[model samples]
Target: MAKIAYILLCHKDPDAIISQAEQLTAAGDCMAIHFDARANAPDYVRIRSALKDNPNVTFAAKRIKCGWGEWSLVQATLNALQAAVAAFPRATHFYMLSGDCMAIKTAEYTHRFLDENDKDFIECHDFFESNWIKTGMKEDRLIYRHYFNERTQARRFYTSYELQKRFGLTRDIPEDLQVMIGSQWWCLRRRTIEMILDLLRQRRDVIQFFSTTWIPDETFFQTLVRHLIPKTEIENRTPTFLMFSDYGMPVTFYNDHYDMLLGQDYLFARKISPSAHDLKERLGVLYASEGVDFPISGEGRSLHAFLTGRGRVGRRFTQRFWEAGNTLGPERELFLIVCKKWHVAKRLVDQIALETDIPCVEYLFNEQETPLPDLGGIETTLTKRSRHRRSVVRMLFEYFGKDRLVLCLDPANLDVIEDFCGDTAKTRVLEIECEYSDDYLIGHARRVGLAGENSPSETVARLLPPIRNDLAHESELIRGAGIDGYQRIREAADRAENEAAITEFLGVDADKAQAVMRLDYLFSD
Candidate 1:
């Protein structure tokens, strides 16, 4: 078994830190913790008292006032890493982690996997060869000298930067020092940590240079590891998953994101919400378990498409449209069929799909969940995905092919119905304008087993309101789709005009739909 040492860098919430300390050290992996010097002393006191009884935990010797994009952050980490090394010299591997991070996999699995892989897991991209720092000043962060603290004294930091540029006070960085930058989180072999620490004792010039560079914590270990270690010995990936938002801020995980988190292959997840008690308690269970069952791979494409749009990058002009309107894929022909009677629309959809070469998908956004993609391998449920329905619909336009597809929808998806209606260029609305008796919905529900354990009257009562409300929008929906008039089929007395109108709108041969147009969808059985 591999003895692992964890370096925990924390700033706030003593209760959270204490709980995490207990859980992390549960498998006997020793931890060396460093509290930010600027945090409340009471918090540190509370944390120490809580974890003091645990043999696997230790505190760093020195605490420093750490700030964003400052050398003190690196100093604080160095303090913890050095302290952990001294306290647990037999530890085979050292992993860098933060207070908010929690293990997604079991400790036994992590230890066993690390024992097998001898290579270091850390991101170390060459600064000159890579476009690592994209947001702010690229290489200018290294070429300039930063004196005042960038976090607390922001005004002075900017003034000093401008002054250095005006006065030509830029310093020369050594050519031999291969400066690199990447994610701060990493896992390294004991030999790698010792070698870097030993070089830190000998290489004061390199340390002094990185001290003034912006966000050196992201660059310090990264640069040293790449420069010293052979490329074959590095994996160029972090053990901890730290996701960032578009604005360069950490994306925190919440209670609702449990299934999304578990589906991933990462060893640990970071920036977890402290208030997510359910997620926290569940994760605690998973962390202590002996074995894990990973879900079947490559399933949940429809579920994913429902939550997120089609996972494809659009071309230049379409890219802007995709971002602005939240639409994906090329323009395709979309036909929406709705009616006052649900079975009328459903019957037409089934017949069209059966008789013609065209694919007519029924009940797309209905409770039945169209085509019912196999979900035995998926963990997330439909209730959790209901919030993303519109996104699914918007992206579905692209997924349904660029030529044509006929679809059936209920009033529950009227918002999407209106969207399709608005895109008159490639979309057409076919509304069966007629007042059918309530018997159609009642019989159809019983035949399809939609009535479940309820009586037909009760099920129809439950399903009637949305249909009534949705059919009220017929004029607006058809008008938006550029359709001129209604195909009114009232009863057994009226069928000819409705059949002719449907045949003309569908552009199908009268011979194909002759029997389909004559049958009353309700009394056909």
Candidate 2:
């Protein structure tokens, strides 16, 4: 007799929501879906039309404009809870879900498990005691009042925060409530849900205080369920298996996650991409079937790591790559091959790869097609930030070991070249200026929608000298272009000795390669 009402909060993908809603109510359970007020009118209309005939399915009356990291999220959840209560009067428990979540377990299994447990399944962690917030802004979340949405309006959020700090302005939590944080997804006893709703009505002060705080949806019910329910009667965990990236965005599932998603222990897997039709269809069958539950793999390292990153060293590499700010560089010498033409640079890279045992990376800056024709990716390379450009360079140097890589630079990322080349300590700038920087500038202008801004000669005459001055100090200044430029770089790479080095050079061995690279970055500014 464990009647569950699943509250689904959705903004987009009506078809997926409809699919989930049908399966949910088909299992004899009820559902309340709250579509975001900001979502397309057509989408909302379509959802309502599809589910209108189902007696067990209902939509929340109030749809709030649910901005990310805003209090509106909690309000939407409350509205859905109210709708669920009214629509399913005999509900024994409430389960919070997102629109994109797919059930991995059969609906019958969920009902049976809930009946056996007979307790509120929710995560309620005291922030001070446990480190729950991965982004590391936990204390500030409750202690300060956030006027702007952190995710959407980062600059304004930080500005408001700084202003508050400057003026010594602060917000206080009520002494009666214990500040807690946890996942928003949960399954609560009907009594617990009713009590929380009643408390919101009676305690205007608490609601008012939480209204302006950042991401109150995470803490609002999380804190309350702990305050209301007895310790032993509640289970501090959620049934949904949700995962997020280092950037705090939810990890999306696709058609390829077929086996892992089906074999997972959780009742549901979250943030499924709209393109995941194959997996969704399979899960639909699983949801309706009376099949055996996947055995719980004993608690250990999880496959969640593979979901966000590539392989074994994924977490360590990501952490190292991003955290490296002042300490970003190769530990030894680096050979930097610079060119204005994409064809010349890519040609030299390929040639170098064949000639040497060392790692040769083409287009150190990512473009649509590094060695071939990818016009769109090439255009994106033109707008890429200097920091991102340099960060990847640092990542490669770190990954391959210093003096172990030869990176090719194209005018596609001209800013990174100018900035990086100025450092003659670790990097040796090898370039043959065949087309006087002006030729590259004019060609790039038309592609980037800047040709109309200035005539070719005027743009070059106004820019060439100063650009030359900036690069003159860094570049080796060889007077060659095209085929000659490619030939010159190849000859440089083929050499075994250098005037700057006392020892002979070898392609793979850094100890010997240092002779040809000559410059060391250890003391470089």
Candidates' lDDT values, in order?
A: 0.70, 0.68
Candidate 2 yields a Cα-based lDDT of: 0.68
Local accuracy of candidate 1 as per-residue lDDT tens digits, 1-525:
788888999999888888888887887788999999899999999999998899889999999988888988899999999999998978998888988888877887788778888889989888878887777776778999887776689899999999999998889786787888889988899999999999989989888898999888888999889888999999998877666654777878778656555555567888799899888888877777887764422212222332233222222222223334543234556667766456677777777777776667666555444563433322134442333443454444445433567776653344556555445335555666555356654554444433332332333465455334444554444445444432334345356666676676566777765655755564242
Candidate 2 backbone collisions, by pair: 368-377
lDDT digits (tens) for residues 143-245 of candidate 2: 7888898788889999998888889788789878887788988999999999999988899988888888888988889889888889898888888877776
Which residue pairs collide in model 1, if any? none
Show model 1 residue runs off by greater than 4 Å. Answer: 128-131, 296-525
Best by lDDT: 1
TM-scores for all candidates: the values are 0.63, 0.59
Error of 1 at 291 (Å): 2.9
| Residues forming the 10-long window of minimal summed lDDT in candidate 1 | 310-319
RMSD of 1: 11.6
